[model samples]
Structure formats: structure tokens, C-alpha cells
Target chain A: MSRKLLLWLPFALVFVLFAVFWLGLKNPDDRIIASNMVGKPLPEFSARAAMPDRPGVTSADFTDGKPRLLNVFASWCVPCVREVPVLLRMQQQGVEIVGVAVHDSSPALATFLAQNGNPYDRIGLDEGGRAQIEFGSSGVPETFVVDGKGRIVHQHIGVVTEQDVPQLLGMLGKAQ
Target chain B: MRRLAALALLIAAPLPAQAQDYAEVALPDPAQEAQASRLMDTIRCVVCQGQPISGSNADLAGDMRRIVRERIAAGDTPDEVRAWLISKYGDWVSFKPQVKPATLPLWLIPLVALVLGIWLVSRRLRRHH
Candidate 1:
């Protein structure tokens, strides 16, 4: 009986390997890079305004006992256009948004906000995407729920659609 | 002929801009440049996912390369730079995984399999003889 089981060992190993591979295929972890910056205090950096009228953003801005959503976007990004209405709705609900414009020009961002409607209280220009890296953001259209203490509570990659609005709001509420 | 010339101009227009990106800029010191180049190969291009930062042409990768070169030029050791990147991007950014408790199996499995194979082969050979 023991000898017979030993004969089947290679087959068992192969089956186990195949199962792991199949599970990976079923639910791929390909695109989601878990940010190390989550639960950490926001990196110390200040950014200039991406528009003429809006004020610049800084790390000190978040510690004023208010939890806000920090949105990383660019005028050139298409999904940011789709995300504007959802953000505006959130803004209307009394949620303050802090925007970081990575690799964007002031004129382009001004144009984008003019067409889509500006929802940000302050818009920071992240030259050369340095601030995005500090925030552990890989691409544009990422949202972070920053707590009153300036710690990043949650990171939402990709476009924040209507479906994600409630969850983000809930996270923000609990961030205190 | 006019359309062909216009197409050619369009294709050539973006080349210089790409060539002037951070990845193309090298550190003044040869030793520092070589160190930065090696570090780039180990770092993942977060935007491209599969390719290393050195091999990727994505804008983010170019910025990362520039940061690496700048940090090296500013007197940071290669390990320090790697640690800094890991702090920002997590261990996923490095191709070489550290041998920790969770990754111990990944490090030891091949050696264990090799020993097992050799033992099984020797045992089978002895039995056949």
C-alpha cells in the first residue's frame, strides 16, 4: 500500500501545481500592486497649483482634522474625464477633494476642469510624476482616502465610478 | 508623394522627444552610471508590469530611471536606493525576493527537489542492480 502511494507521488505533485496555476488564472493578481504607503503618513512634499485660480496642495493641508479624498489624475488621461461626474457628486455631498495632477500642463488641466466641472478644493501639479511615486501610485486616476491625521487609509486604483462612491465615502467616514 | 512626406515627418517628430527622456541621460561618473544601470534591471516598471525599468519605455519608467541616477549621483549607495524604492513601491518592485519566512520555501524548494531526485534515482538504480 505504501509502495503504491509512492508511485503516485509525481502525479500528485503535478496535480497540485496545475491547481495552483488554474487558481491564479481564475483570479489574476496581475494589475493590483498593493501600495506600501497605505496606513503610512503622507510623504512630505508640496506641489504648485496646476491651475491659475486654485491653491497648491501640501502634506500639511491634510492634518487640519478633516479626512479628504486625494485624487491622482492627469488632464490627458481619458478615465479622469469619466471620473469627474462621480467626484462632483461626492463634492456636492460635502466631501472635500484634493487633486494631484501628474505630468500635466496648467493650460490642459484648466481646459479639462472647464469642460468637466472642477470638483477639487486645491489642485497640485506633480512635475515629472515624483509626487505620484511618493504616494505609491503607479498610474493616473488613483484615489486615496486620507485620514484626519494625514495617513492614507485606502488606495483605489483605476477610475472611481458611481459604484465605488459609497464605499469611498464610507472609508472616509471611518478614517477618523 | 506629398502625403508620404507628411507621414514621414509625423513619424520623425516624436523621436527626438523620446530620445531626450531621463533614461537616455547618464550619470557623469562611469562607475555611478554602471551601478544605476544594474539597479534599473532589478527594478520593475510598475506601468509596464513585466518589463524591468531599464527595458521599459513608459514615461513612469523614465522618471524612475532619472530618480535612480539622481539618487546615485547624490551619494546614495545602490542598496540605499533599492531600499528607498521598496519603501515606496513594496517588495513587488524587486525581481530578487528576500529569503524571509514566507519566501523560504521559494528559496529552498529547488534544492530540496534536486536532493530528492538524486536520492530517488540512486535508490532505483540500486534496486535494478
Candidate 2:
């Protein structure tokens, strides 16, 4: 608390704040989709089945002891249409994908799946999109890599292009 | 001619009517509706960088508005509704962050700056007096 120390304190604080800003700008990815729910247990959710024959998806589905992708999408989402093939490719590699169709009509969703080929292991319909909010999704086509123990390891916001597949796989590989 | 050009520009730039999805025209109880609207003003649109859900016409913001109204109409207080959103979307969703251990600095820095400014001003006033 000396006068000399006090004189230097403001500059030191400004320097620290500048460094923090610089570091944040250095890695833009972390700030792109900030979520407090990352690295935490996936919240519980249940929604009606999008398909008639398949059972609806629930939080209990993830407890089956396998790592999987919980994807929030809608038939109305153009980006969701674009990502269909990538999801299918992931499925080909034995990735388990659970789908939650948000703010969509069941008939329209069925038609979308029929046209694009369904890649989901199980599908759920989020009528009000309340379930999507629980997943901390900013918008449609957000994906969470849930580990075997049901912890959300990583989330990919926005369109999941082909390039993101490997990075997502790497996250799943790193998760216990 | 200038007014006509301005009108043309206005008509040419189609409004974002489609983006808002009409937001369901159903009106709820007047008191509850006002409460929900106020709450929406306080809640930030998670998808939007810094805008409140009430101001955003984004689809997700529309969904947030619906949920806010639904919860409030179902007898939840505004604080309870906000707490529920925070549970799902975290403190970032609320423009007014609750006073908690982690947010103490965010809540106090402005106050500290204000107090310092006032003290400096008062010291200058005393010298002048």
C-alpha cells in the first residue's frame, strides 16, 4: 500500500485487462459459442417421437453406456437440410445420433427424413423447443458430444460441416 | 421527389415480418402479459450477441418469448421464470446478472469507479471552497 505501489497499480491492472482481451481474441473459437453448461451433465429432457414406430427420445436414452451425439434440428432449418449427409456419414462410422426436431410439424419432419434419409438412431419432437433450451442451444443444428457417462464434452454450434466431423470425433475419443 | 424516393426505399427494403414468425397473436391476461413483456426485456437473446429477447425478432428469441409467457401465465413469478431460464441457458441469458460470488466484480466495478470519481470531485470542491 505504498505510494509507489499505488502509482503503478492502475497501469498493472490495465495491462492485465489488455492481456485478457488479447488472449480472448487470439482464440476466437472459445468465444464463438460460449456456454456455461459445457463440461457439465446433460440436462434431463423428454419429447414426443418424431416417427410413429420409433420410441421418443429421453434423457434415459443416453444412460445406455455409449457416447453419442445429441442433435437439435428442425425440418424448417435450411442448415439442418445441408448437414444431413454429414450426419449420415457419421452414422456410417457407427456414431450413435439422437435427434430432437424442434418447433416442427411431425408430418413435415417425416417428409424431410423421407427425402433426405433418416440418420438418427432415435428421434424426438420438441413441440415448444423448451428441451432445446435445456441443451443450451443457441439455435438449430447445434450438436453436443455426450460421453458415455452422459457428460457433455463439447458442443458445435451452427452448421456442422464435413470438416467438423474429425474434431468432434477427436473430442469423443478424448472423453472417458 | 425526396419524400417519394424515401418511400420507395422504405417499400423496397422489405421488413423482417417473416423472421419474427408472427409470434402467435394470442393475448393473455393483461397483468401477466405486462409482467412477461417486462421479463422478456430483461432476458437477453442467447442467440443474439447482446440484444434482449423482447427486441430480437430471431426465431429463437420468439421461442424464448413464448416460453416466458407460458411460464408466467402458469402462475410463475417473473423472478422464477428468469431463474428457470438461467437454469437452462445460464446467467448470460439475463442482462441483469444476479449478485453471486462469481459476478461480484462485474456488479461492483461500476460502483467502485463511481465512488472514486465522486471522491475525486469532492476533493477538488474542498480545495476550491
Candidate 3:
């Protein structure tokens, strides 16, 4: 190799390293821990009813020939409260939503629903958070779009804003 | 001064009692418990982001620790337990990356850098001599 080319190699290497780091840092999905359960069948588990009035959620509920949104939420999560109105709006559009109330009790969820207008068709109380973990959910307020066969078609982290409703609807439409 | 001390006690009293749910108990077999603890150190706490479950105080981490102990007590090898967690949380949950095609670059980059450094140093030294 030429002396001039060799001299420039170190600078080129530094520039390449900088570009790689910059691209990694700029990636929007960098902070999001992608779930391994997407495209897989829902893990078999049963959760008791979060509130007496609602039915308990089970894996069998999703296996029926009807796609639905499985919302993992908690009464204590502030973002879950923010997400309620959007979920209610989705429910208005005839989107069936099942819920896993992570580490929450009946009274707390009952109060939450009364305040925010219940959107869940069925709400299961995941008192130990085991069901949430089995679903590959890291935290509260994550939503999974499950198809008729019970495969997780999409996993959405964080509160679903008004802007996200159309995208979710699209995913749900495709899921069917 | 007495009122301030009373207020401090009230605040501090609940701190230790809060959210130490599943991790409070260890496996009955000391050998199994030791294996569980070792596995816990290698598993990242998803909620805490990079801290091991053994070091994290997060409720989820506590649950993970409990799962580890239970699995170990049931005769699961540490590798099997790690695989179970990785299956649920993805490879991100494991601090120790598995040797696979996707991770080849991660495993090789350091070796590549070392080789390049040695070649460069040897070239420079030879020229000086």
C-alpha cells in the first residue's frame, strides 16, 4: 500500500466508527426492547377476573376465530389512565379488547374503570405479573394485536395516543 | 426535634417493607439456591435496563429471581433457565450473549481490533529497526 493511503487509514477508520455510532444512536427503535413473542401463539395461562362483573381472560379466548387487542395495563400506571380514552374510542369502532391487569386488584381496577370508562371486554387480574412476563411484556400499558389463531401480530409499547389509533386499526384489520 | 424524628421514622419504616415480594425466599436446597443466584447475575432486569436481577430492586426483577429459584429447584440447569428467560424476553434479557451467526460480529470485533493493533505496531517497529 502507498504511504499516503496508509497515513489516511486511521482518519478513515475514525470517521467510519463515528458514522456507525451516530446511526445506532439515531435509530428510533434503539430504546425499545422488542418482544420475542410476536408472530408466536399466546402463551397458555389463565388469569382470574379483575372485577367481578368482567370475565376472566384465558388463552382460549384469543384462539376463537375473532381477532382482538390484548391490552396489558395497571391501575397504578398513569399512562394507562391516559390510554383509556383512546381504548374506549377503539372499542366504539367495534374493536374487541381483552385486558390483563398487571399486579392490580379488583377494587383498584373497578375504581379505575368507573373513572375512565371501561374499554375492556374481559379483564384478568395478573396479581403476580407472571402472565405479563409470559406475554413478553416488560411494563404496564403494552398492547398486543392478536389474530384469530391467537398469534401476536403486533406489539405496541407505551400509551396509545390518538395518532396511534389509525395505525393500530390498520394492524387489527390486517390481523383479521 | 421529637416531631421531626417521628416523621423520619414514618417515612423510613415503609421503605424496606415495600415490594420485596418473590425474592424474600431462597430454594430449600443450598446447592440449587447457589445455582439460582448465579443465573440471576447473568440475567438482565428488563425494568431496570442493564442491571442484573440479583442487583435490581425492581418488582419485576424480584419475580425473575423467584422464577430462577423455582426452576432451579425443579432440576433445571442454569442454561435451561437462561433459555427460558431468553425465549420470553429475547436475547436482550441475557447479559451473556450466545454464540450465533447474528452475534458473530460482536464476538469478533474485539479480536479483529487486537489483531489490527498488533499488525500496525509490528509494522511501525520493523520500520524503526
| Top model number, lDDT | 1
Candidate 3, residue A138: CA error in Å?
A: 1.0
Candidate 2 lDDT by residue in tens digits, A1-176: 69789757777988999999999778652235455678888888898888887778888887767889988899989889888999999999988889999888789988999999888988899976768887878878889999888888888888789999999888777765
Per-residue lDDT for B17-66 in model 2, tens only? 44322245323367987888888889988766578888887877888888
Error of 2 at A142 (Å): 1.0
DockQ per candidate, 2 decimals: 0.53, 0.29, 0.42
lDDT winner between 1 and 2, please give it: 1
Per-residue lDDT of candidate 1, residues A123-174 (tens digit): 9999878889899899989999999999999999999999999999999889
DockQ of 1: 0.53
lDDT of 3 by residue, A1-176 (tens): 69889878988998999999899768633356778999899999899987778899999999887899999999999989999999999999999999999888888888999999999999998866788888989997899999989999999999999999999999888886
Best by DockQ: 1
By DockQ, rank the candidates, best first: 1, 3, 2
| Predictions in order: chain A TM-score | 0.86, 0.80, 0.84
Give the range where candidate 1 chain A is weakest over 10 consecutive residues by summed lDDT: A27-36
Q: Go through the candidates in order and give the clash count of each.
A: 0, 0, 0
Interface quality of candidate 2 as DockQ: 0.29
